[model samples]
Target chain A: MNLLSIIKRFAYDLQGLTFYSFRLFGKILSRPMYLMETFEQMYFLGVGSLFLVVLTGVFAGQGMALQFSIELADFGSKNYLGRVMVIAITRELGPVLCGLMVAARVAAGITAEIGSMKSSEQIEALRAFGIDPIRKLAVPRFWALMVMLPVLTIVTDFVAIYGGYIIAVYIANISGAVYWTNVTAKLTLGNFIIGLSKPFIFAAIIAIISTYMGFSTVGGTRGVGRSTTESVVACSISILFINFLFTRLLVPQIQGLL
Target chain B: MIRFENVSFSYGKEPVLRDVSFHVKPGETVVVLGISGSGKSTILKLIAGLVQPDSGRVLINGHEMTTASEDEWSRVRPKIGFVFQGGALFDSMTVGENIGFTLIEHTDKTMDEIEVTVRETLRFLNLSEDLIDILPDSLSGGMQRRVSIGRAVAAVDPMIMLYDEPTTGLDPISTEAITELILKLQSVKGVSSIVVTHQITDAFEVTNHFIVLHDGVMVFDGPGEKLVQVQDERVQSFLAPFMQSVKNIPAVCPEE
Candidate 1:
């Protein structure tokens, strides 16, 4: 209830998550790879989420292009729509939107699944069989999300840029060639670095927070629901906060490097 | 063989097990009796190394498990199979996969060989081969419990198997069948066991040795017949309700 206690709980959660991430990293690098399970997770998470990601990208790109075109028209340079769209979509909105949306979908599902397993004693059963649940259950999801998020980000970036193309060329009456040229003009290495880095970081954060909430679930079905809700909320807040830090701190540094 | 030496455990400030001690020799069966929250399952959990004691010791096959690392416990764990009361099958996995999980994870056997072993395990459990492809949720409680046992026994010759409330929620026929299956495993595989249950008849049917726990403390430990003779009021009270039910049963039916 108090701010101090809240801070303490958050610190405690971070500590547990750090240890969990360490153990996960150890298992992921070592022997006993669950390649089939990893591939299964990829298909489930990546392919399963393709539609959602694409939809988010489309609306984001279209809206940004249209809004920027209207603003630039007052300055007699509506042609700058594509350039502005590319910068906003690729550098900031694309990865962040994709991260948050996927985090919403995936984090809840992971927590619910693993939380139910925890309540059912299935988690304990895995350990009793001489298998670590982290290695068997969490490892596959971790690797899957790690691999899938970047790939999904690419899909999102591509779809978003295309959506910008549609809005600029058709709705805004900008020439396709000029639109694409402006889009490429803003596609700097700095932009790519900032855009791509967030998803991987977001992936790690989502997997760690969701899986941690899951394993720590206490009660029964009520516990499962509570943890699932907390997993999504924590993941969304963490993703947004990290995105802010990434933009504020990393962007200037990346721009300096460029 | 499994042995506990004055093992005490508490989930929080409240102790779940208080200075409990017992031993199961190789190829022997010991039934642990207790009501809900009486620490019967905790004893089994301790032996399985799922939880360590707050004080004292747990020796599983000569290793002091209280101090064992996860890796050490992993090495020793496969020798002990645990059957949770609720079956605890992986719902995502089908019945065959559940039974073959251990082999699939730990053994070098091919899928075909594993399938054969699963079939053999199902046969040993007296379950039909047709049930292998179904999900665990679809099966009756009794069938699920049997499949759980089959899964435990499917992989290796488990030196010790721990069953927690194995017949708690089954019909009389199912209860009798589960008790018989436990007996069958002991007779056929020579597997040692510690069966936990509040089902007095099923507990009595499964073993000669009995250990009773009340309020997180061991109330009685001795042969099954001697359990009734213990002057402990807590032990008598624990058995009182089940005893009345047993007494009401007619010795012979009219048809007999």
Candidate 2:
């Protein structure tokens, strides 16, 4: 396809996704809300995703500490390893990695489930029964992700920090007091806020893109598979892109706070 | 009652329905007979407000469905029940939950009230109370379709019910059960209905009025005997394959 056609198709898709997301938001604010379904989704998306987030956070923190400790020891600044780990993990790597992991797991599953429903005409059946699929299906998942991602990010931050502490004090032979002192000196409230804010944006991206893919799915089972793959790829890329934009915008304001 | 006024619809460049016009009176059952891709199911979708026609108007119980907004459509939807060809039961939910979905979401009834209605609806369809907690996939195809019908009729008494190829993939006994259920609903509930199917014998068994669609146009619109007497070569050619089976079965018209 020509570049102009490709650009046109991209714009069309963006427009559709934006329209669908706004419609879902409107339904969520309307009356007769699906409170029970929302709680169910929170359990499914939040509690179900906890183990993977914890695993990813711990390993990422340990690897960063180990690599940085060796590099800093060459310059005889090994005591600063804790400072580096705290700053990087808290302000940058923690939220972004957690978002990516959740996107891969949760977004793909949401797309596949809804796509299958669409293929089977269950989505249409919802409308036929006077129940909007957006209100019954999409709204619950959207609110659940919004409420859960920030909570997951907080848990990830604590787990990763402890993992870094383990590697710094036990493996790197840094004195525990000295390591913690440096870490506390470098970590600021502004850093924590910036990190916590990222998962919210990522959550929106994953939920909106995955649900849109499912809603627009056609054909049948083969079409559902294609939609799932597209949802995951689109969510991952959008999260990374938005992460950079958020960082660039927030970093300056956070620096002023610090 | 439902009315289609010169409704024309197409998927991209291919026309599905071209200037098709028909109406079903209150308490009447109209069976739409057509070959595959002849736009039989599209008629039901249009009546249920699932898809808009490319042109012309669709009216359900005097409400213009083609131009209704989402909220307006939602208000109108509960007055009509739709049975999809594959049953379209939510796989994640149990049979009882699936049947009670509309009641729970749209009504002020309590759980006990809803369960009583669910049990009554299931029993009316000859389904056992023991099958209530089982998932749809675990049921046989016939049972699943009956459960789908039960879901449609569980809550409020819809004024109109649309069935899209209700017996498309079923054995003889299962098809007989669904046909009997359709007839029972008509006699018991007095709801107007439009059944879309390619099955000739099934059509003869359930219809008071018969409409034939061919190449996106209406080829015949009359009673069951008149449908068999259609002189159009296209109509004759279409019915040729099913003619023997249709003759073997006694006509069980709703009017009779």
Candidate 3:
């Protein structure tokens, strides 16, 4: 298929899966809630994702610092490294990159595990036993990512800035006070908020797309691989696209209100 | 207790089941025998309300599966259990956790009570206590099957047990063990069963009634022994291959 047709097919499939997920979600909360299952999913989707987020945070911090300091050093303004590092990390890299990392780690894991369960008829077995798969499996993980992603991004943003600051001051021989002053002067609450905001939506998108892909994955190992690939690619693209749109729509309004 | 009347289903437009009609009376064990793609397992899904029929109706205890409310379906579902082909144990969970999943999800049982119940059920399945804490990924095929069966039984006392190709991947010994377990569950649990399989001996050993589907249509409905003596030429041709291969398998007794 051509690119346009592929996009159209993807949109249609995504819309249908979204509708199905919401419908099942409604049923999940109505009665006979799987409270324990939800808790279990939360642990799987949230607690297990910590190390990945932390690793991404540390690496992103150090890398951004190194790149920014090198660039600023040419202009004899290496002291401004912290300001650039903070802005890029918080407002762009923190949420977006962290979301991508999570999309790669947790989203793929969710998709593969759930997809395997689905192909193996374990989902059908759940239905046969009076359990709603959404309530028992999907929603908790969905909400877990939805809740955890933003928090993880915030942590990543802080860690990244700190890592960058440490590298700029100690390794790159920039003055600590100058770096602090530049970052503090350029950085605002708005930037932090802006950076942190995207993760909730990003998390939601990742959870929805990944869960849907996993739940609907057909065939065997090939199918699981395809779904996992689709999940990461689709989630990352959606996160960036929506981040741009959200910035255009919400950022101006928030600036106006402030 | 379960019935399908003129039910039709298709995946996208290719028909998988066409005008299929069958019924399992209360507490009766019905075996559905067919070649792959014959819509045998689809019947279980139809009855369990997993897939809505494209046409006609599936009635479980006089309520249409498609029209039943969520509450109604939930109320009905607990009365049935499905054991899938590959055991389908939650890989991340231990054997005890997998079995206690249903109890934990749907019941108000305390941890202590659930632990007791899980231990009791494991013992009932002749599983060692040491197996309880091991992850499902560590379990053998027969052990996995037992754990899956244990999970299915944990929710409530199922009045109907559905087995979808239970013996598909097992060795002869394991197959015999599963077949005997199916029989024991029927007799001891006093539950109805609908098993879909290609294994003739499995059909003969566990099910009293047999339903055969050919090309998505019900071709025969009778006792298990009658399958061997059916006058239908198509049925005879279908059995011809199994009959030829039956000699290769020794007439071993059912596993304990």
Candidate 4:
């Protein structure tokens, strides 16, 4: 394709995404909510992702702490490792890492599920019965992700702190009291808010991007696989890029509040 | 109940339907016979408001579907039942859930009431109640089609029914079963229908009025008996291979 065609296709895709996002938002706010499906998705997207998110958090925390201890030891400031670890994990790693994991697991699954439904004509069947597929499928998943991602981020934040604590006290030979004091002293309420809020944006990105990919799927099973791959890649990259944007936009404002 | 007046539709630039026009009146069963890619299924999709024509009009129960808004389309959709070629049952849902999906989503009916209605609908479609809780993947192809029909008729008695190749790949017995079901739905339930199929025998079995689409044009439109008698070379060549078998069975076109 030529540059003009490529640009035109990109514009078309952007327009499609914007329209789909608006429809999703409208359906979500409409009456006769599918509470049963929404709660089911909450269990699936939130509680179902607990083990994976926890595993990611623990390893990421331990890895960051180990790297920080090695670097700080050069300056005889190994005692400050806990403070740095907690701040980094809570302010950035906790939300982004958790978002990435959920994006891979939950977002890909949502895309595959809905993509298969589209391929099999089940989505069209929903329409044949006067049921909007977005309302029935996307809305529940969207609401569930929005509600659950922050909760999961909070869980990851605490778990990562404990993981850091384990590494600081045992591996680095820092006093447990000093580590706890530094960890608690470094983080403010603004940091917590920033960390928790990132997942909300990430959740929206994952839900909308994944659902959009699924809905646009064609060509049966192969199309479903392509959609799943596209959803994961798009959501993962979007989360990373948006993380930087959010930090740049929100961090200064949050620091000002403190 | 369904009318297509000078409708023309295309996929991007390649036209699929070209100024095709036909009407299916209440209690009438019209079968659209065409080779693959002749835009047979497009007609059903247009009637279901799943696809809009590029020009002219598609009317379902006198409502102009081409210009209708989303809410307006939704209001008209329930009045028509569409049975997709592949059954299109929700794979994640059980047979009962698939059949009762519309009721559970749209109606104020209690679970007990829904279950009762589901059971009755299944009975009407000749499906066993024991298969209710099983997922659609576990069912046979023919069984899945039956469940699809059950789902279509479960919510409300639709005024119009559109079937997109209801029996494409099936055994002779299964094909007969589906044709019988289509006939029963028309004679018993008084549901108007537009069936799109390439199966000549099946079309002859179910439809009263027949229309042939070749190269996106309606080449023939008359009674099922007249389909075999069409002078158009394309229609003749299309039916020449099936003429021997089709001739064995007596034509049974219902009186208008």
Candidate 5:
């Protein structure tokens, strides 16, 4: 398509997303909350993802610590590796990595499930029964993700710090007490706020974006596949862009206040 | 009762329905016949208030849907049950859960009461209670359709039933069973219905009242007997192929 047409299509999609998101927000607070479904999703989106998150955290932290220690050693500052690694993991790497990874896994799954429902006419069936599909399906998943992602991020953050310790003290020959002290001393309340808060924002955006894509699905099984793909791509890009936006907008104000 | 007056609809610029006017009375069954892409299912969607008409009025029990708010539509929607072509059972849910979905969502019935109602609905639909706890995907095509019907009626017991291609892509036995259920729902339950199907034989078996649509236009609206007599080129062509196939069948076995 031409640039003009692409721009127009993007505008159209944004308008649709805005309307769908607002309607979903209304249902998120409506009565007759589906508590069981939310808990089930918590099991699926949160607990189900524990192993993957831990594995990601370990590898990421190990790699960062290894590279940082090697560079700092050349300058005779290797002892500061723990402090720098902790700050990086908590302030930036932890949230963004966790958000992107969960966005890929959870967002894709939600889109595929709901897209299949949309294609199968189950969504329409829900409506014909006077039951809101958004309230029934999306609301539960939305709330579950919002509650689960921060908890997952916390797990990722601690595990990553531990992973850094393993690499620094054992592999890099740094003292364990010094490393632990530096890691703990570097973690500020503001850093924790930023770390925990990004996951919540990511969770909300991912939930809404994925559900919106699912609802917009047309065609059939192929359409389900298309929407699932679109949602994963959209969600990953959104997480990155929004992470940058959050850092640019919030970090300064938070630091200034501190 | 459901009524549509000069209703027109389009997806983008491609008109799916145009100036269509028809009414289904209480306890009456009106079968809408059209070929593929002829806007047959669109009529049922309109009746269920799933889509809005661009230029005309749709009334459900004297409530004009064109100007009605979403709250008003919600109040009107429960009186109708939609059985989709593929059954559309929530595959993630067991058969009992699927049947009990509307009840759980809309009614104040306790879990035990809902279980009782689901069992009764399964019995009502002639399905084995053994199938209740199994996922709908594990069931056969015909069984899934029956479970969908059970789900539709298990809840508030909607007075109006909407069936879209109720027997498409089914074996003859399953086709017969669904037609029988449709007839039973009409006569036994006294539920008003608007059935949309391309299966002329199935439509004829279920209802004498008919509405024929072609190219987004209503070609014929009358009884089965009158539909057979319609001579409009579009109407004749639509009915002739099916009628000829029936007529071409030999009366006796070829082995004889």
Candidate 6:
């Protein structure tokens, strides 16, 4: 298939699964949900990804603090270091970097797991059993990623801000009061929200890309690998592209709104 | 009953199947025998609606495969049990869970009811109770096929069972077990079956009707014994590779 046709097919498949998933969710809510499966995925997709999120958060915050201090120090505006760090973390890099991390971790896992299942014909078997693979496989995962990534991004923002505070105040010898003052003064609700919205979009992209990759996998073992790799690469690329789109299109609107 | 009329499928510029037409009636096992890459599995996939034909039509019980709504297709999907060549049992679940999947999905039946069904299906396949609790990995090759068969028949006794290369990679004993299980599934479950195999022995033992696909076209369509009497040189050459693989058969080629 040509690239456009392939993408069109993928989009069609995604739309079909999305509709199917919502229908299954209606069934799920009517009866008992797969409580145990949801919980396990929450732990695996959300909780297990915490360490990487926090690790990336801490270092990212420290780097931002150091960079802002060094740049603004030359202009005798080092006192504004905390303001820059907080804004940077809360409104942009915090969510974006964490999203990239999750694209690597969570998105890759879902793709590989589901892709392997597809290749092994487990997915076919599920269909034979009257189970919609989209419901059993895709929906639980999409819901997990959708709910978890945003929460994880929030935690990442907080952790990054704290890391910046420790580095700017203790290591850079900036006054703690000045740091807190600028941060409390400049960081606003609008900034927080602009940052928060990116992860929701990123989570959706991750869900779409991973589920698409998983469901479309052909061949056998090698195809699963290709799908997993494609999920991560496609997700990371799409995240960056979406980040730019949000920054260009939404950030200025928020600034105007505020 | 499943019917195909002038069905054609192609990937990109190349055609995999062309002008294929056939009907599989209830309670008959139809074996599609072909060389590797002959599109035998593709036929099964088309019947299951996993892939659409580029031209013509496929019907299950007189219902068009192409025009069915998603919910309608989902209902149709359960009636078609597919045992993939690889067994395709979910590795994440235990044998019990794999077999119980259909019950869990379509019905509001209790876990107790589901478990009873799973157990009875397993027992019918002559598998022991110990195999139920273990994961699919712990089972032998033959046992996995049996478990997959059990899972295939778990919830809705399918109107049609499709076996994709049922004896592709198995020891003689395992192959025999699979063949017997294939027979049992057809006879007891009372479902029409389509088995895809390169093995002539498997085709002979497991089918009454046979369709030999060559270059994605149906070359022979008749009773199983009629396949042996065909005067076609190409068919004889195709049958040559698998002939020596059969064990303990008489010298008579075949006579109906």
DockQ of each: 0.84, 0.86, 0.72, 0.83, 0.79, 0.55
Q: Model 1: per-residue lDDT, tens digit, B1-256?
A: 8889999999989899999988889888998988899999999899999888999999987888899998888777877889998999999999999999999998999999999999999999889999889999999999999999988999998889899889988999888888889989998999999999988766767677889999899989887656766789999999888886545223311111
Task: For residues A158-256, write the lDDT of model 6, one tens digit per residue.
Answer: 888888889888888898899889888877888878988898889877877787688878888999998899789889998999999999998999889
Q: For model 3, what is the error of residue A20's alpha carbon versus the real structure, in angstroms, after optimal superposition? A: 3.9
DockQ of 1: 0.84
User: Distance (Å) between predicted and true CA of A82, model 4?
Assistant: 1.8
Deviation in angstroms for A75 in model 2? 2.2
* Every candidate's TM-score, chain A alone: 0.95, 0.95, 0.88, 0.96, 0.98, 0.87
Give per-residue lDDT, candidate 4, residue A16. Answer: 95
Screening candidate 3 with a backbone cut-off below 3 angstroms (N, C-alpha, C), the clashing residue pairs are: none
Among residues 3 or more apart in sequence or in different chains, the pairs in candidate 1 whose N, CA or C atoms overlap within 3 Å are: none
Model 1 Cα displacement at A192 (Å)? 1.4
| TM-score per model over all chains | 0.96, 0.96, 0.90, 0.97, 0.96, 0.88
Taking all chains together, the TM-score of candidate 1 against the true structure is 0.96
User: In candidate 5, what are the lDDT values of residues B1-256, reduced to their tens digit?
Assistant: 7888999999899999999998889988888998899999988888887888888999888878888888998887877889998999999999999999888888889999999999999998999999879999899899999999888888886889999998989999999999889888987899999899988877777777889999999999887766777789998888887986544222311111
Candidate 4 C-alpha lDDT tens digits along B1-256: 7888999999999999999988888889888998999999989888887888999998877878889998898778877888999999999999999899888887899989999999999899888999889999999999999999999889888888889999999888888889999999998999998899999888877865889999899999988667777789999989998988888545454555
Model 4, which residues run further than 4 Å from truth?
A1-8, B249-256
- Which digits, one per residue and each the tens of the lDDT, describe model 2 over residues A88-141? 988788888889888999999999999999999999899889887888888888
lDDT of 4 by residue, A1-258 (tens): 899998998799889999999988888889757899999999999999999989988988888888898999999999998789878988899999999999999989999999999999988888888887888889999999999999999889888888888888889998999998888887778878888889999999999999999999999899999889989998999999999998998889887887
TM-score of 5: 0.96
TM-score of chain B of each: 0.94, 0.96, 0.92, 0.97, 0.94, 0.93
Best by TM-score: 4
Ordering by DockQ: 2, 1, 4, 5, 3, 6
In terms of DockQ, the best-performing candidate is: 2
Evaluated on chain B only, what is the TM-score of candidate 5?
0.94
> Whole-model lDDT, candidate 6?
0.83
Give the alpha carbon lDDT tens digit for every residue of A145-208 in model 3.
Answer: 7677887888788788888878987889988888888888868888867877789889778878
